[model samples]
Structure formats: C-alpha cells, structure tokens
Target: MAEKIIKGIVIDRFNFRDFDLIVSLATNFGVIKMVARGVRRPTSKNIYILNPGCLGEFEIFLARYSNKLSKLKKGECFFNLDLNDKKIYAFWKLVSQITRETNFVPKIFPILEQSFAKINSKNADAIKVYTIINWIKFNGWIANLTRCRVCKTNQRLINFNFYGGMECVYHQNPKPFFRFGRKELEIFYWSSSNLNTFLEKVDFDYIYLVFEILKQFLKQNSYIFL
Candidate 1:
C-alpha cells in the first residue's frame, strides 16, 4: 500500500508504556487514530507536533492488514500554538473528551483550526465561547428559538423541552426544563450573527449565558453533558 499524508490537529493522545503513544487527530477527512513509536523518549522531535491543538501535516504508513489504523512516521508543525493558558487548555480538553472517536466530519478540521487561531488572541475567553457555539451549530445541535416547536408560529417562547423545543406560555409544561424570555432571545439572536461582529458587541458574561443555553440544548439532544 502507498503512504498517505494528512493535515490535522492533535485533539487527544495517550501514553503507552515508556516510549509509544496512541494519538487521536481531527482532519478534514475525519477523526483518525495512529500509533507513534518512541515519542516519549527525551530526544524525540515529534513531541511538539503531537500535543493537542497543534496543527500539522502527518506522514503515515497505511498497514495492509488494517486501514483504520496508521503508523505515524513523521510530523511537521504548521504554526506555534500557545496552549499554556489554563482557559485555552481546558477548552481543548473538553473538545477532546466530547468528540466521538473514529467519526469523520469534513467540516470539523477547518472549524477547529479557526477556533484555535481565535483563542490564541487576546480575547481568548470570548473566542472560546464563540468556538463552542459554532461547534454546536456545526454539529446541528441547536433548536430554533425564534418560533414555537409545536405550532410553527413565531411567539414569545417561555419554555424549552429537550425533546421538543421552544414553547409558548400556553403550551409550556409545569415541569422544569429551560425558560426563555426577551433577554434570552436577544442573546440567541446575537449568537447567530456573524462571529467577528458579535464578539465586538457582547462580553463574556452574555456569551456565557448563551453558552449555558447551548450546553442544555446539547445535553437534551445527545445526552452528553459538556
């Protein structure tokens, strides 16, 4: 078989014994796993390129027996990414944890790259929130907040159901779910707008509100709590 090269970001990695590793990467092609031999040794040059959030090109050998796994032969870093900030570090950790292993999404790689670029800037927290919101949207996990999920009419929705969506006061259930009002709607509107412009207008506080709503939305849809 021929060698395959791919550009991707290291999203997660695991140490195996003394000098080997199992790495999980997100590329335009999809999420992939590979084995890196001797990377943990003190003289290894591949260590920097294998860290989570490092965007790079990987040269791998495709084993004839199993195409699902690859042997990492070489790695080249695309950019020097700063992952030392605790906030940025935490965000990447969460991303690695929630992302499904072996699932392929063509759009995920570019989005991850753009997100890391933004978070590396001075407005790291705000961009982190933006990235999370975009992640949810890219995955199609959001519910329509502008109209009623049942009646298909635009109204002031007062409640949200995990299975259903936004409900008007007349249609809402007594049990606890999510409650929305004018303020929440405004936040949703802002979140849906252009990210660059939206970041200029809203601070982290407002973004956090929207983030919490998105978190709940994700929980109901995928049963995964972020």
Candidate 2:
C-alpha cells in the first residue's frame, strides 16, 4: 500500500525486538496495529510518539503482496497528556486495557482524542469516567438506565446486571452486579449527559462513585475489553 497518514491516539505500545516497537492506534478507520522499526534506537525520532495517549498523525505503509505487519514510518505528535499525574495515567491505562480492533467503532477515535484534549488537573477524575461512559455508550453496551429492563417502569432502577441491563426493586437479577441506592442512581443518571454538563453538575465527591461503577460494569462485560 502507498504511504498514508492517520490521526489517532497511541493506545498501547510494547517492545517488539531489539530496537523495534509494536503499537496499537485507535483511529477513525479502526484499531490498527503497526510496527515501528528501530524506534527504540538512540537515533530514532519516532520513539516518544509511541507513548500511550499520544495524539498524532502517523505515516504508515503496507505492501499489498505481503502478509507481514504494517509499518509505521514516522509520526508528528499533536499533544500527549502528562502521564505523571495518577488519574491521567490511570485513564490512559484503562483505555489501553479496553480498546481492541475486534471491537472497533468509528466514533472511538474522536471521543478518545476529545477526552485526552479536555482533561486537566482540575477535572481529571470526572473526565476519565465521562470518557469511559462515552466509550461504553458508543459501543452500544450501555443499558437504558431510564427504565427497568423487565418491568418497563422508570422508577426505582436500583439494580444493574452484568449484561448491561437495568432493573427495579420489583424485578431484580438473581446476582446483580451492582445495587444502587438513591444517591448512586443519581450519579449514574447524570453520567449519561454531555461531559461538560456532567462535570459542572456532579460534585467531585461523586465522580469516584461513577468511576467505580463504570469499572465494575466493564469488569462484568469482559468481552468488551481486549
């Protein structure tokens, strides 16, 4: 294939051989894996752009007749979050853990980019939760939190099942993954809104709750992760 440029995030990277690296990039097309040859060498300029959560445009190539791994020729970093902060680091780590080519979607790329761009010291916690929720929603795994899955009533959706379904107290899963009280339910309610509004309305105290809930939600939905 001719050389092409793709704008995306470096979701995961690992040393391949002596001086090469393998990276997974989440792009509009899909989750693409490419080998960056000799990027680990002292003379290489592309090494730093392989960091997880680095947003950049990569020049890539593949030969039509070959079945070998695709090649990443060079990269130009747009920006990368400061990975030293614990929350920011955790957010990118979670992103790498869940994202995969088999589960790829077009909207995933922009959502990841937007979340990385918008996150900062002030709103790191909420932004991480917001991005995961958005990812879950876009992947069509999020349940209708507004109504009970079985009873079809909106009231008292106090239980969340592992399969991503909601149920009221009147109808509950035999082994529900999470049982939400009024407060937890409230947190989940606003989590569906746009990121900015969610950050504005939800107290910092509740952001951790949302993050825990989303974490468990994904834990149960293991197939969604890589």
Candidate 3:
C-alpha cells in the first residue's frame, strides 16, 4: 500500500462499531469516505484530527478498495481550526449544505478550504464568510447565478424558470416567475465583486437574505435545501 497525505473537510460522519467512525470527507480529489478506528473514544490519539471542520494531514494507506471505501492507516491534525462556538456551528451548517446540494466535490474543495480559512481567521467577518459562500454559488461553473438565462440581462428582478434561463420581468409573465429582490441581487453582485472592500461592507441582513434565497433556489431546482 502506498502512503499519501491529503487535506479535507469532514462533511458527514456515521458510527461504525466499538468507538470507530466512518467519515465522509470532501477532498481536493472528491468526496471520499474513510474509517477512523477508535476515534470516538476519549483516549484515542486520533480524536483531534477527526473533527468535522478540522483541516488535517491524513496519512492514508491505499488499500485495493481504498478508492471505493476503506480506512486510513493513520491521520494527523495539521490545522485544528480554533473557532468560536457560533463560527463553528455556522461552518458546519455551510459544510452540510454544500454536501447536500451537489456532487461536484473536487471542484468545490478549493473554495471550501478558502472559506474555512476565512472563518477560522481572527479578523474574519461573519458577513464576509456568508458573502464568500454566496459568491461561489453564483460564480461556480455548476450554478452560474449571474445573467438571466433567457435575456442575459444583469437586472435584479429576474424571472427564474428552472428549465430555461432567468428572464427579465419585462421579457416574461411576471406572475409565473419568481422575483429575486433588489437587496438579494445586490448581495449576489457584491459577493462576486473583485473589490475586497465590498466584501467587508455587506450588511448582515442582506447576507442572511442571500443565504435564504440560495437555499430556496436550490430547493426549487434540485428539491434539496442547503
């Protein structure tokens, strides 16, 4: 077996047997599950590295079936990510949402790592963290939240048709389509902005609203709530 190290975020966990855990990790390669024996026990030396949000250097011994599902030979915590209680919960919520919404794990790992680093930073702004998440949803190759799919307009009051592209209210029947509010549009625009100053200046209410909108959008399209 070849030994290798990979950094990842624990997206989900399930108890196996006798203090062991099966963790689903979102790594740069993709979503991979690994068994961490004895991780649940208080005396387990690997306990520190098995946490949900911790970015760690996992030493994996590639079993023939490791690519399918197997246990790592050993693991170590590279970054424990000392976060406040609120931030920790928020981080976990974001991770859970991401895991639920899409299967494009490999592509999202870089963005996830960046978000985690920001959340763990001493000067990290909660609003900025929220903005980063919203930004990725809009700009990601998979989602592409910008520009109406039909008219390709950058207008705020977009008419969302799940199958077709977004249409401007003027271009479509207003009653049937869902409208993304001005504030919500601003949040998306600001989230995708290149200026770091805008990220820091976003209001909390708008941030929360953006999250709600994205969650609803995901639910509408994929029947999944993030």
Model 1, 147-206: lDDT tens digits are 666785666677655444457777777774656555554554455555566566665555
Clashes of each: 0, 1, 2
lDDT of 3 by residue, 81-142 (tens): 55466656655655666665253446556656666655543334444345344434643422
Off by over 4 Å in 3: 14-19, 38-43, 66-68, 78-88, 100-104, 120-143, 146-177, 193-198
lDDT of 2 by residue, 122-148 (tens): 788777776776677677766665677
Ten-residue stretch with the least lDDT total in model 1: 97-106
Q: What is the TM-score of each candidate against the true structure?
A: 0.69, 0.73, 0.67
From the highest lDDT down, the ranking of the candidates is: 2, 1, 3
Best by TM-score: 2
The Cα local distance difference test for each model comes to 0.67, 0.74, 0.59
TM-score of 2: 0.73
> Which of the numbered candidates is closest to the native, going by highest lDDT?
2
lDDT of 1 at 105: 47
Would you list the clashing residue pairs of candidate 2? 1-62
